[model samples]
Every structure is written in C-alpha cells, then in structure tokens.
Target chain A: MTAAATAEPTRRDFLYIATAAVGSVGAAAALSPLVSQMNPDASTIAAGAPVDVDLGSIQPGQIIQVFWRSKPIFIFNRTPKDIKLAQDADWQSLRDPQPDSARVKQGHEQWLVVIGICTHLGCIPLPHQGGFDGWFCPCHGSQYDSSGRIRQGPAPLNLQLPPYEFLSASRIRIGENSQA
Target chain B: MSGYSTYKPQSPFMQWLERRLPIASLIHSSFIAYPTPRNLNYWWTFGGILTFMLGVQIVTGVVLAMHYTPQVDFAFDSVESIMRDVNYGWLLRYIHANGASFFFLAVYIHIARGMYYGSYKEPREVLWILGVILYLLMVVTGFMGYVLPWGQMSFWAATVITNLFSALPGIGDPIVTWLWGGYAVGNPTLNRFYSLHYLLPFIIAGVVVLHIWALHVVGQNNPTGVEPKTEKDTVAFTPYATVKDAFFIGLFCILFAYFIFYIPNYLQHSDNYIPANPGQTPTHIVPEWYYLPFYAILRAIPNKLAGVIALGLAIISLAFLPWLDTSRVRSANYRPAYRVFLLVFFAAVIGLGYLGSQEPTGGYVIAARILTLYYFGFLYVILPLLGLFETTKPLPNSISESVLREGSPAGASAPASGA
Candidate 1:
C-alpha cells in the first residue's frame, strides 16, 4: 500500500486507541473518590471517623451536637408536646418541612438529625424552644421547626443531614450509613 | 502593441489566488478606509484594552481548566496539585485567578471612559446598553466561576447568594430548589455550577462580539464629542490607532504581569485557602471586591426584597443614562457641573465598596443605606435634572481646536484657519 492509503488506517487506529485510553482514565478518576467515599475503611474512618453517639442523655425538646468526620451533626430528641407545638404553630408556614429525613435512621421517630450548618449562610443553627419552639440561625434569622425543617428567613432549604445509621437502641453511627 | 507590452503572461494559479484573496483590498478596508475620529484620546483606547484583557482571560482560563477538578471532594486538592505538582501550573493558576480581577478593573475603566466622553449618547445608546448587559453577564460568570473551587469563601458565597432567591414571592421555594438542583447546596449544585461556569465565558465572548459590532456601527466617539467632518479630521485605524492601542496595552500588560508575579494572592480572600466545611461557617462572609458596591446595596435596605430590587436597579440605571442626560453637549469636558457630579458618583461607589467589606454594623448599615439612596439619585435625578438646568461652556468646533487650546499658553495663540 502507498503511504497515504496505509497512513489512513494507522491514523484511525491511533485515534481509537487514544480515545479508549482517555475514556478509561476519565472513568477511573471519576469513580475512585466516590467508591472510597462509599466504602470508608477502618483507617480512613479512624483518622476522621464517624463517632457513635448515645442519645439517651438528650432530653426531650432538646438537641445534642455531635462531631462526625469533622462535621457537626445535630441530634434532637423531640417529645410529643414539641411535635404538637411545631404542627399547631403558625410558624410552620416556612419552607422545607422535612430536611432532617436523611439523618434519621429507619423506624426511628421523635429522633431528629441535621447538619448544624445553617440553611442560609451556613452558620450553626442555635437550638432554642421558646414561643416558636425551633432552631434559629442567628447569622441571618433562619428559623427551623422541631423536625429540622426551615420555617422562615433567608435560608433556601432546610439544614442538611449527613448519612448515618443506628448501631443499637441508644447508639448511632454518624457517617457512611450502611442502609444508604 | 499595448496588449503585448503592458499585459505580461501570468500563471493561472497566481491570478486565481490574487482574485480570491485580494489582500490589498482587505488591508485597505480594515486598516485604512475604515475611519476613526482623530481626536480620540487615551479614553477611547479602553475599549481595545478591554478586548485584549478578555482575550487574555480566555486563554489563561482554558489552560487552568485543564488541571482544575470540579468535584467538591477534590476541587481544593486539585487546585493545590496545580500549584505544587503541575509544571508552570502556579503561573497558569495565578494568571487565571488574578486575571479575573484585572478583567473587572479594565472593564470598570472602560465603562468610566465611556461615561466621561459621553460614549453612551444618541447613536451609541445601543452600544452602551449592550455593554451594560455584557457587564451583568461578566458579574454572573465571575460569581459562578469563583464557586467551582469549593473553598471557604466559595462555599459561603454560594450559600449566601442561593438563599437570596428564597426571598421571592410564592414560587421562591421552587426557584431555590431548581437553582440548587437538590434540597441543599451539595454535590449536584456544584456539578451544575461547574458545567455553567465552563460555559459562560464563551457566552460572554458572544456578547462582546455584539458589543463591538454595535460600537463599530456607530463608530467610536471622540474626546471632543464632535463627529469627524472629513478624511483630514480622522486617521486610518492601522498604524495610528493600532500603534497607540498597542502601546497602552503593553503598559497594562506590564502591570498585569507584575500582579501575576509579585502579588498573585493579593486580591484573593485568605479564608479561601481552607477547604470548605459546611458545618463551620467563616466569621466574615464577603464577596469578591468587584461585587462589593452592589453587595453593599443589597445589605443596605432593611427589607430583603427591597434590597434585591435596589441592587438590580443600580445596574439597570446605566441603561437609562442615554435618555437621562438631555444635554446637547455630549462630553463632560464642557460640563463643569456634570464633572463634579461624576466625581461624587465615583466617591460614592468607593464608599459603598468599603462599607460592603466591613461587617454590617448599625452605623455602617445606616451610612450604606443613605449612600445607596444617593447613588441611585445621582443617576436618576441629578443626571437628568442637571442636563436640563446646568449651562455648559461652549465647545470647540473640532478636536484639533480643543487640543491646541489646551496645549498653548492661555490666550497666547490665534485659532488655526480652516483647511
């Protein structure tokens, strides 16, 4: 074959090989972090591990702050009265009715969970149960209900909930939830 | 005899090439035939300067993007890798990062130049309006691009700005949801922002084309505000304007290079050095300096919706400038009153920027609100009313007269005779 005719096939082969290499590299690069995040190991977890928290100390109508993987997670134990107050109040008109869903383990009721970061400007939401009976982000006046739902103010969404799972009756692991 | 002697035989290829290319005609039209007003001063060169800066930004940005990671998990680490690992990545990263600030600097100067010379007047109104739109797009693109790094400031800035949409009426919740692409500002939001951030620069480039096209249609306004009368009153754009623009551009590049080399991180927020932690909020969440003035306006008003409206008006007000100034004279040179007002306007903007950088204290907030009110009043009230009442000094018939008057000693020489 002449150089031109032979060159065409060689060029096609080179392009095909180059594209496949790049495609594989891209896929690997993309999946690596996600896979690691998915299956966090003992060493990785130990360095900046999810802490198991005993919610027995958390009183009804009160929230407990727990550190997990260097992030603050809010674990609120709401009583039936607190739930009734949230549902009956006019402040329930706020957006984000149920933002703490991801933080709550399956079949767990009256146990609310959320990332302490404010839904507005990421200020840690201060826990209070006054007339409104919810959390308030003092930085921008973002109000949240007993269920960690945004009630009012500048926050666009309810507070985030990091993945977590229940280890026992009183214990909860606050990162890399196995169920998720 | 004439045909045989005068017409020499030529190759068909050469003839065909000459006809198709017409290099001489192309050069003639682009450089020589296309007229620019002779009186164009340093101010007129800013448009060209802005064009050059835009080109630099795109070039540097493309190179930096090659190494940048858009994922929240790796974005900060990737930026560090670029600085430490990649060859000359520090240079690329610094240039792209600081290039954003320099771009805004040049654009501000360009806009100010337009204002001073009344480049926004009459036939140039559409051009000016297009410039305003381009400016708005630049702001949005910058905001989105800043968030891709997923640093402290980037994360907080995204959170602060995204939350503003929640202040909207009934559909605010849906709007915010659509904006975030999820319940919270998380991985999905970051991914979409990365995609859009990569896309907006090209859109800015497209708008800039329209900007220049509109500019070329009206031709550039000169310092004297007097239109060119004849070929003598104008110079060819090639050696004259092109060389002058090149000189200024070189000087500007030197300053830019100085920043890239000497003080690369001077414009950057220090907190951005830290990786984003959603749980811990930075004590002070401030935007980039270019956005300070408008951010001040946003915080000035007590009401959320009103503050947003005022900030929007601050930009939209520029669009009405053509109609606002009713003065027959276009340039600020002849309008003493307007010059003072322009100075005041500049000072007010600086004041607002300063206030925006500080924590919104009671005193600062009150001052900002007052200044914000005055800022709008300057454009909406003073500009229009002054144009009606303020008497401007008589303008020279041509640019040459204006230049000669300023150059010579006061009342020292007679005016030049008509050519």
Candidate 2:
C-alpha cells in the first residue's frame, strides 16, 4: 500500500485523502458538545460531595448501607475478631491481590467502610454471605474476602474503596479524598 | 466518475463565485445533471427517501432533546411531559419516536433493494461497506436512544445488552465498570449514553454525505445489474430522477404520518410505559422489532459467549458480502437460482424476527435454531455455492436495450457515453 502511494498521486487518490482529512477535521470539531458532556456537571458532582455518616449508633459486627451519588456505600463496624480475620486471611491467591492492611485506613481498621456494589457486574453484594464472610454478589457468584478482595467467581477486582476518612470516634466522612 | 457538467454561469458575479468555490458546479454535477440509468424503478428512490428521513429525525430529535432530562429520576416523567404538557410536544415526540421506526423501515427496504440488485459488487464495494458502517452506527444510536426513556424495557434491555459484553473472559468486568463508570449502570452510564445518542446522528449524517459522494463517484446500479453502455442508456438526474424521488417521498410521508397520528405506540413495547426499576426484570425481555431477527440469532445458541459471538457475526457477515458471493454477474434478475435463495432469505429474516418477539420456548427455540441456520446458510453457504454453480440469463446488449425494452422513451433521456 505504501509503495503504491509512493508512486505519483492519481487524481482519485488525492480526492480520497483530501476528503478523508476534511471529514476527520469536521468530525473532531463536531465532537466538543459530546466530549464536554462527560465532564461531571456541578449538580452531579455536588450530589457526590462529602457525606457524613453517624457511626455512633451502629453496633459492632453490624453493616449498614448508605447512598452517596446514587451508589450504595457499606459501613461496617468490625469487632476485634472480625478485624483479625480480615487481616490474617491468605492474600496469595486472590483474584485481585490486595492485603487487608492496604484496604483499611491506618489505625482505623475497626471501622471498615467500602462501596457496597459488587465489582463483577455492579450488583450490590450481600454482606456476611460468602466463605470469607466479606460479601457475595448473587448476580454473578463473585465472592469477596473480608478485606474486600475478590476471592472467587467471575469478578476481576475487589469491592472498590471509596475515598473516605474518620471524622471522629463516632462519625465518618465519605467522598472526600484527603487526610482528616 | 461520469463526466457531466451542468453548470455554465452567464453573469459575471456568478461566474466569479463559481471559480472561487464552485459550489454551484459541485451541486450541478453531483445531483442536478448526474446521469442515472433510465430503467431505474421506485426502489432506486429509497436512497432519496432515506436522506429525507434522516433530516426529519434529526430535526425532531433536537426539539425533543431540549425538554428531555438525562437523570434516571426525571427521564420517564420528562418524556411524559413531552407527551402531555409541552405545546405540540406530543406531535414532535411521536414524530421523533415513530420517525425512528420509519427510518429503519426505509433503511431495511433500501438495503433489500441493494441486495436484490447486487449493488455491492465490484466498483461499489466501498459504497456498500460504508452502508454497513452506517448500519452499525444506527444500531448503537438506536440502542442508546431506547435506553434514554428510562422505562422498564429500557433499563433491563440496557442491563441485558451491557452484560453481553461481560461474556468476554477476564477483561469483561473492568470493561463493564469502565462503561458504567461505577459499580452499576447508574448516572454515569446514562449520561454518557445520552451524550453519545445525541452525537451519533450527526455522525450518521456525515457518513451519509460520504455515501452520496461515493454514489456520485461510481453512479447508481440498476435492476439490470449491467453498467450503462452509451448515451441512450441513461437520463439526467435533474427532472427525471428528481420527480420519481419526490413522488415516493410523498407516499412515504403518508405512511410516516399515519403511524405518528393513529398508532404511535404500535412499534413500542407495552412494558416501556412503566418507569424503570432495576430490581424487577420483565419476563419477556426483547429488543425492538428491527433488532428482533438478530436477537433471535443471539438466543438460538445456549452458550452466552457463543450467543454474543453469533449475534455479532450476523452483522459482521454483511460487511464481507461483496467478496462472499463470487459471481461476475451483479443482478439477481439474471440469476434464477440466486433469486430463489434471496426470497427465502428475506422470509427467514422475517420469521426470525417473529420468533424473536415471542418468548423463547420449546418450539420457538427449535424454530429459531433452524431459521438461524438458514439465515447464515444463505449468506455463507448458498450464496457462494449458487454463484459458482448457477446459470444466469443472457444479458441485454446495453442499458438502453433494457430501458427501451421496458417501454418507449420515459422522458428526454440525456444519454451518457460508456458503461
């Protein structure tokens, strides 16, 4: 193809190149309206802004679901044994290999918070259902360890960790990516 | 291209403008005075009708978009308001909705016309491939548009179809998440689909310009499938082709208006009236009528991945058609064996579409499997085999012979030289 083109340009060849170039440029210029739309709008971003959850009322060993930006967020108040189990589980053979230590915030491991939605196909994973006792996606049979690492089935990643921080002994803030 | 120039400016200012941009000359050469085969039928007019339909869809779609919200909470209500509250919004919304159905209606006929006439053969391969590209765009745009109303069928259809991508091994989950921009098909997915749904029609329009440009470059293929041979074989596109296209456009508009006015929901699913609830899935989840035939092919296979592959191949096969049927003859009119297969192929498609709409069951599944076999068999097996083995009728000496044989002179035929 290169050799054929290297030979002097036929009129048709010129027309093809010129029209393709012109069409491509026109397409690029026309795409701004759509490309600009994907950027998070003020209202949508504002909806996902930092939300504070009252951890004071929640008892140990219990998990509750909260909504931020229309996504379900799971806040788990882990007991001492729950924290030890999550940290001590073998991390060598995970579908998404991340250690328990890496998942939770340093010195705040007792308050385990993760996005409630399953990574397999985005269905909400039911808590305390799998062999690992983390979560189980009924939609696609994905199992997550207590650390939220995918343990089995078709899911390729662990439950996503939302940007969150401990606000106090009894409250936590989500959707803010910063050291509090 | 055929060398026919319809422009000759007498006024000095017009001549100066012509020399600068030659817009008048381009239009004159491409449309007004272009040479078309004299024996062309109403089937040939569908290309013009499709062009008109595209414009109508874009105009109506743009107006509908102004009042339509993209959020999941408000999308269903917004559509209801468009139907109930907005001034003449019902007319515009119905026209846009039914216009999509009519657009596909015209396109299918247009495609069948090309297939029957062998318009995809040599020198026209690029033209046909561009059409396939246009078709894919239409499918994507149409799918996204269906999801925008945020109805029961729309949500589940989006769920089912999006999950089809997860049939891919390993990479599937990440791709789905990336597509959704989150764990589920929530705000991000809807926003992106809305943006793309709005964007693709203009892209279709752009490709259409290319389709027409290529048409002008190579010229139209007639029912005879023979290239024009001399001046007597063809007529100028101006009054002759224009008049035919106009008449057909009028007839097509009548059909389009009837559906919009009397039966706007005829093509829509009854389930779509209910607002989208992600938790509840309709028992009989089906795609639109235009997509049914392919949907049937998808469900015929029990395996999920294979079903997706089969569904994809049904469309991909069309792109390779120009090379698939290796016959020197272009028109099926001359190939009696080919003609029989084409009719059966058309029926098989319609049958598959019907099976698709009904719930897949014992008989339906078995029938879909058989029809699916025949559908692929026609393109992959029968078409190629017939091309090699079948005996075609003797060709007319020229396009003029074919045209003159049809009747007397249809009009003032500005015959062009050479096939």
Candidate 3:
C-alpha cells in the first residue's frame, strides 16, 4: 500500500479516539455528581458529628455562635425574665408565636437553640438589638423575636432548631438529640 | 550523526493521513474563514457574553457539586458547610448564585436586542429558534438549581411549580409524581433535581454552541438591517467587531460585579432562610423575577391545562417570529410603526412581570390578563399587519451609506469615485 493510503486509517483512528475520550470525559463529569450523591463520603458524616457546645460561657440574654457539623448554630441563654418577656401576650400577638412547649430537649428553657439562618432570605441573621432584641436579615428587613420566631418580618416561619442534647449542665451537643 | 538522526521515512501511515483527512481545511472553515456580518453592532456582543457566563456557571457549578448534598435532610446543611468550611467557598457560592441572575439579565437584553433589530427575521429563523430553545433550557436549569438548597422557599417553590404539571389533563398527576420521584417534593425529588440541575447547563452549553453556529451561518443581522455587499462596505471580524464586543463586555462585567458585591440577596426570596418544611406553607410563593411574565400568564387562564398550554405557547411563539413578521425590511430603526409597537410590547412585558409579583387579586389579575393578551397580540397581530401596511423609510444602498448618513467620522471620507 502507498504511504498516504496507509497513514489515512491511523489519522481516522486518532480522531475517533480523541472524540471518544472527550465524550467520555463529558459524560463522566456529568454523572460524577449524581454518583457521588448516591454514595456520600464516610468522612463527611464523621466530620458532621454533633458539636460539643460550652453553654456556661454564654451569658443570659447573650447569643453565642457555635459550630455544629460546620454550620453556625446560635445558642442564647434566655433568663427567666427574658423568657417571660418573649412569652408575653404582646410578643404572642406577633406573626409567629414562640412555642410554649420547648421544641428542643425538654427542661432546657434557659438554652435557646436556633440555626443562624435568617427566616427571611438565607443570609445569616446578624444579631442586632436596637428596637428588636433578636436577629435581623439585612437583605430585606425580616426580624425575628428572641425565641427565633418571626415578629414583624416577611419570613413565614421560625428559625430552625438543630437537634441537640445537653451532655452536662454547661455543655450541649448539637446535631444529636437523645429525645428523638 | 546519521545513525543518531534515525528518522523514520514518511510512514505510509502519515502520508495516508494527509491524503484522507484534511483537518487544516476543516479548522479553517469552522473557525477562521467563517463570515460573520461585518456591520454587527455592540448589541451582538451579548451572544458572546452569554457563552462566557455559561462557562462561568458550569465551572462554579461543578466545584459546588463537589461539596453539595442531594439528600433532603443534608442538602441545606451541606450548603452551609460549603459556606463555612470550604476555603473561599463563600465566594464561589455567592458568584454561582448571583451569576444565575446576571445570565438571565444578559439573555433578556439579548432577546430584546433581537426584537429591536428584527434579528429574528427571515434567514436567521433557525438561529432565533435555537435561541428560544436555549432560553427554555436556561429557565428549567434555574428552576432545578433553586430546589437544591432545600430551603423553605426552595421546597415550596419546587412544590408549587412541579404541581403545575398536575394541571395537565388526566396524565398530569402521574407526570408530576414521576417528576418528583414520588407523590410530593421530597428526598428523591431533591436528588434528581440536583442531578439534572448540574446536567442541564452542559446541555445549554451545547445548544448555545449551536445557537452561535447558526448565527455565524446566517451572518449577524445589523442595526441597519441592510446586508454588506462588498469589501468596502464591511470590516474584518478581528479588530473591528472584537474591539466593540470587548468594550461592551467590560461594561457588562462592571454591572455584574456591582450586583455580586453590593446587593447580593436583592434577587433572592426571604423564606428560603428556614429549612424546608412540607407541613407548613409560606403565605406568598413567588418565583424569580425573570419568570414573572409567564407566571402571570399561567394565572390568567381559569382552566389549568389551558393555562399551562398558553404559558408554553407564550415562549414557543418566539420560534415562529421569523414567519410572523412579514416585513421586507428587518430593522425597527427604519420601521416607524414597528418601533412604536416594539416599545409598547416592552412595556407590556414589564407590566406583566410586575403583576406577576403581586397577589392575584381583583385588579392585578385583570391587568395581568390584559397585558398577557397584548403581549401575544404584539407578536401575532401587530407585527404581521404592520409589515403589510406600514410605510418604511427609503433604503440605504449599503451599510456605508447608513453609517455616513448617521454622520460617523469613520465613513465620512469614503472614496469619492465610488457609486
């Protein structure tokens, strides 16, 4: 066979291989996320274990940020008076009322548990206490009461309370509640 | 030296390749010699901008997928993890989230530019149709991406929108179930939506490539709508078109940066802050602003299936624009009545979008229906009839004539001997 004739198939073979390689890469890249979703990394779960929080260091009526599973969880100790104020009939008149029965672990009235996300837009609520004694979403003017319930805001629900359990009088572990 | 050289003879393999596969010729035709319209304006830069934005989204989205969780319980927390733990994760998340809004903004302008210049007319019909397809895919991609957060708004928005499929006749319920991967928007729904959301952008990238290929094939339509006939009437793509596109892209980038840095959450809904709660529903569920006009159309009709069909048709009508507009002249610049109609059409769309945001009440619903009717009427009735009856300005002999008439210094000193 002539040199030109012999070279032609090899070039075609190269092109075919290149095309297949690119096609496979694109397909693999596309499927990788879906496949990963089906099989989560074991280390991620281990890393996301319930975080141990030091509650004693947090003062009454003061909100403290604690990291749990890499997410910011706000831990505020509401004094009996602060709790009474939040439970006042005036506060109850607001859009979202604070739950009388605790949503978190029982007998932890002093410890207020809430995920830091603003009930309005997902921006982490900045702790502000000018007119309202609670979190404020800077994005659109959504306000929440001290109990993490929507007060005079666009947010339709209360801030989330991550599942948690008290390990001792001064320490709590968020993301693993014994009370189910 | 001869022994060291050890050169193989022009292998039968190499020579055969050169004879059978003309790769150089293919590259030249596809990339180098492809004739883009010489008179294309700065407006045409948006197509390139869109391609760039799509690339940005895909790159950021791929990185995000590496960290995102698809499960309902973990999805919201995973996003939080990405923000708090992943290095520069906050910036990546912000850019991708905000990049979506910017992409839509560019496309809206691109489509509007097409309308104003009648870029969708005649020979460019296939190009416009491809653009419509790309646009539809973009909306779907955006919708699916929104559901990935598993936030309250994300959950309810998915719930509300997927239920629209339920408005379809008898098969609607089943279709929705299949879409959700169950009876309601749950873990399976989030999983599949996340998968598809990540997948659709690449599909959009493919369609956008086709869109540009079609655009290159037809050559770009210009402001004057007059075709360039000769070398004197046209400019090369590199220095002329490239510079113009670069300038506009810089300006667009500034606008994009301003949004990303200053008012990042302006486009986002508030309720998405709370975790997804299927038991509780938000009082008001509004979609992203870009979808407002169609949402208004969806609410206008009393019948569910008919509303869905109308909403679909509102988008599909764009594909028929080339035939719908029977004007011999393409640009609105030369068409006086058409220019007026175009402005009215734009206002009607904005009005519909605004109405879509408000509660579907007594006056708003009526206004939405009226605007929606006008929106379709602008495309179907006014364009075709105007093309038939409206008197247009006298035609310029070439792009050079139009440019000179507009008093551009560049075209002032053209050869005096030219006809």
What's chain A's TM-score in each predicted model? Answer: 0.65, 0.81, 0.71
Tens-digit per-residue lDDT, B126-196, candidate 1: 99999999999888888988888889888878877887776778986677666765445666677778787
Q: Note the Cα lDDT for every prediction shown.
A: 0.76, 0.82, 0.75
DockQ of each: 0.09, 0.07, 0.03
Per-candidate TM-scores read 0.73, 0.73, 0.66
Which parts of model 2 are misplaced by more than 4 Å? A1-180, B408-419
lDDT per residue (tens digit) for residues A41-64 in model 3: 455457667778778778877888
**CA lDDT, candidate 1, residue B91:** 92
Top DockQ: which candidate number? 1
Residues B46-102, model 3: lDDT tens digits: 977887789889999999999998998899999989989999888888889999999
TM-score of chain A of 2: 0.81
Clash pairs (backbone) in predicted model 1: none
Please state the error at residue B1 of candidate 2 in Å: 6.4
Candidate 3's interface RMSD, please? 11.5
**Between the candidate structures 1 and 2, which one is better when assessed by lDDT?**
2
lDDT of 2 by residue, B77-176 (tens): 9999999999999999889888888888888999888888899999999999999999999999999999999998888677767877887889876666
* lDDT of model 1, residue B260: 95
CA lDDT for candidate 1: 0.76
Clashing pairs in 3: A3-B12, A4-B15, A4-B16, A7-B13, A7-B17, A8-B16, A8-B17, A120-B270, A121-B270
